[model samples]
Target chain A: DAMVIQNPRYQVTQFGKPVTLSCSQTLNHNVMYWYQQKSSQAPKLLFHYYDKDFNNEADTPDNFQSRRPNTSFCFLDIRSPGLGDAAMYLCATSRFGGEEQYFGPGTRLTVT
Target chain B: SQQGEEDPQALSIQEGENATMNCSYKTSINNLQWYRQNSGRGLVHLILIRSNEREKHSGRLRVTLDTSKKSSSLLITASRAADTASYFCATESDFGNEKLTFGTGTRLTIIP
Candidate 1:
């Protein structure tokens, strides 16, 4: 089955420490996205890559950043972890202008 | 405000019953989609309804889209315990942007 993969299903980081979450997809979709999901809230789009073009949400905090070096891989880096930044980070991929996106298992980050 | 708003933040039902979730959006959309997420897991695409299409069905899942009202609904028949999850509605805006804006979501619990 075509799948998206995320590493370090659970992550713990000290306050102000920088941490990185990684994702890879076998589906070979052209667009990759990173979302932050807190409990009882909608998954908020942090940024995405359409091929090599990086599109960040206007409200996304400066601490969040992404890198999509190639079609198969993408990474989310938290420049400084805060308690508010602790949430499940999801990675999704889809072909450009497609109806559905395939998501990975997710990385749960805990900022202490 | 979120592009889509799913009513009834939570639902509890017995197995074999049907589950219905409604989503209302604020703007014209190219398509609407449903997705499911298990606790601590990423979303899985369930079904999609394009703006031009009124309704679509797949197996036990049925989705209806009303472009005029900018609302969509998802019906899951013969629900099971395994179906307990958070269900979300996502909308692709009229401009053909690939990113899907998701709703707050409905948490469904199927008691077996």
Candidate 2:
């Protein structure tokens, strides 16, 4: 099945240490997105790549960065992990324009 | 806030009952969509309704959009235990950027 995949379903990192989460898709969708989701809350958009053009949400912290090295792969790098940053990181993909999105199983990050 | 709000933050219903969740947004949207997320899992796309369309259905799921009121509703018929999850409504704005603003999700529990 063509779907999105995320590596390290559970990640543990020390405080102030940098952590990288990976996402890849076989769907070959033109748009890739990263979102942060805390317990009992909605997934918050962090940034997205629309065919190499990165669009970051205004409220996204500088510590959060994303890279789409190619069409199928995207990475989320946390410059400095914080306790509050411990949450599920979700990756999604969709075609251009207003369309439905397909999401990966998500990476659960734990900052110690 | 660009994000939408879903009413009845949580719901509990018996199996075979119908479940309905409502969402309201503040801005003009090009399309509205509904998604389901299992506990500690990624979101699954349920249905999508364009602004020009009023209603859409897929199997047991039905979605209704009212662009004039900036609101949408998702109805799940003959709910099963497998349907227990958090449901969210997302909107694609008129900007056509495909940036979706998701509503506060509704957690549904189906008691078998």
lDDT values, one for every candidate? 0.92, 0.94
Q: Would you estimate the TM-scores of all the predictions?
A: 0.97, 0.98
- lDDT leader: 2
Taking the tens digit of each residue's C-alpha lDDT, what string does model 2 give over A7-86?
A: 99999999999999999999989999999999999999999999989999999999999999999999999999989999
Clashes of each: 0, 0
Categorize the docking of model 2.
Answer: high
> Which sections of candidate 1 miss by over 4 Å?
none
- Model 2, TM vs. native: 0.98
Give DockQ: model 2: 0.85
Pick out the ten consecutive residues of candidate 2 chain A with the lowest summed lDDT: A92-101
| Per-residue error (Å), model 2, residue B97 | 2.1
Candidate 2 error regions (>4 Å): none
